[model samples]
Target: MTSWVDMPLCAVDTETTSADPNTARLVTACVAAINGSEVDSRTWVANPGIEIPAEATDVHGITNEYVREHGRPHDEVVAEVVEALYVAWESGRAVVAYNASFDFTVIANHSPGFEVRGLIVDPFTIDREFDAYRKGKRTLADVCEHYGVRLDGAHSADGDALAAARLAWKMPRVYHVLALASADSLMESQANWYRERQYSYIDYLRRNNRPFDDVSVEWPVRTQKATAA
Candidate 1:
């Protein structure tokens, strides 16, 4: 099987009203195509049917008034985003996302019938597997800096989506393990990696006698707040 490094990639990202995926309302999103060269993407702004908090607006620079004036209806935007993902998946492009669970979970909650199809390559998970002990924040900006991928727009969905794809494309070059494996293999490995990390954190929480009930071990998305370990 050919490595994902040599294959076409589909990347996604969303900017929302809150940092928590379960409660966040999508303000903007982008679906991008990453070939060997660069990312080409389509972006959307949605009214989200709610106020965009000052903090959230500060992060993404998307205000409620901006969306209400220029954005599509929430449902319409979500449907189009899902359809774009379907188009990429149908073309055999593995979805590239940084901390995919957040974006996927948010979209799934917004659209009840949304289910992930095809392969997912999450840089957030894969980076940990490749360099388990690196000590720094793994936010998209941080990871982009670590990988030497230029990130021009920090919080905007379109820029983040493109940057994530660029980082994923750079991973295989730095980690031979990633370059040798197929997308299916990478996806399975990431699932185990995420599960193992969850169990380890669960153990740490138990040792400290802290709350551990809300952690979800599901990869790509967790439909609800549940743990199985």
Candidate 2:
């Protein structure tokens, strides 16, 4: 049996205008392919067609003026990114991301009619499942530290994406059961894991008298609400 670490993997990450995936416009995106000892990466920068808020620019270091002057058009970047993802999917590789739901959702929002294929390996979701009792943060950098993976250039899409891929590659070694499961099985487990986590959060919110109950159980991509015609 082939170890999961040896399998071809595609890691994706994106820098956006805001934290809300539904409304955030992509500022930059990266996709990294890892197969055994070989690794390749591609990055895209787009104007986003909106103001890249000061806070967001500070985080990713991509200013609106910089993108306007050097970045590709939004639609062009989206098509290229989507095509890269599709190629990875078609090649029987797992698509990975730190917080996959956010990146996948942002891509879906931008790609519109394009369909997202392949099994998604979310290192963040997997870490939550395997280390549910561990305290403190689970940000990409935090998880990288926990897994002994080096994550440099924290907010840059290329750096983050490659780090996420390395983290996913390390997960199965930490959790033996994950290494035994097929990619499809892992994807299904992540869906269940996300739902369970959301329910726990909702319960905590309700117990604390907080009115926060709009969380979605969907994995990789949350279902978008229909707009009024």
Candidate 3:
């Protein structure tokens, strides 16, 4: 079987108004396509239709004023973002993201009743499953460095999207089992990996008498805005 590293991948990254996908709005988004040696990308900036909190702006450096001046309508930008993902799926490419659950959930919520279908490649989930004992943060930058991949921009959508693809591309090269596996199968395995990790965390919380009510096991996407603790 051909390795996914040798095939095209459509990686997406979104900067939003909040951490919770349920209430967050799209502030900026990028869908980056990696076809072997070539990289092509599209980016979107949205007004979000609400204030971008100071904390959110600090993370991505995308201010409400900047978006307001440059953005299209929030709904229109979301619709086009989803359409772009659809195009990737239609073209038989896996959709990649760093923390896919968050980005994908934000897209799903912003477009109500929309079906987010595709073979999803989540580098975050893959790392968690494959490198279960490694310590320290798995933020995209950290992961990129851990895998010896360069990330020029930390929070920009295009940079992160492309970085995710690079990180994912490196994973299979590091883990031969993944190199031999198909994206569809690996995505399914990620679902199980996510669930297993959530179960372990919940058990830890229970043992330590901490609240785990908001710990979600959803992989790739969550259909609704979750009130996580």
Question: Top TM-score: which candidate number?
Answer: 1
Report the candidate with higher lDDT, 1 versus 2: 1
Candidate-wise lDDT, in order: 0.87, 0.85, 0.85
What is the Cα-based TM-score of model 2?
0.93
Which 10 consecutive positions of candidate 1 have the poorest summed lDDT?
220-229
Say what the RMSD of model 1 is: 1.5
Can you tell me which runs of candidate 1 are displaced by over 4 Å?
A: 226-228
Model 3: lDDT to the true structure: 0.85
Off by over 4 Å in 3: 1-6, 224-229
- Residues 7-90, candidate 1: write the lDDT tens digits: 799889999989888888789999998766766789999999989999999899998889989989998999999999999989
For candidate 2, write residues 1-229 as lDDT tens digits: 5544556899899999999888898999998888777878899999899999999988989998899998999889988999999999999888889899898888888887867677788999998988999999999998999889989799999999989988888888888888887766777889899878877877777778876545666778877421111
**Where does candidate 3 have its weakest 10-residue lDDT segment?**
220-229
For model 1, what is the error of residue 146's alpha carbon versus the real structure, in angstroms, after optimal superposition? 1.1
**Quick one: how many clashes does candidate 1 have?**
0
Give the distance in Å from residue 135's predicted Cα in candidate 3 to where it truly belongs.
1.3
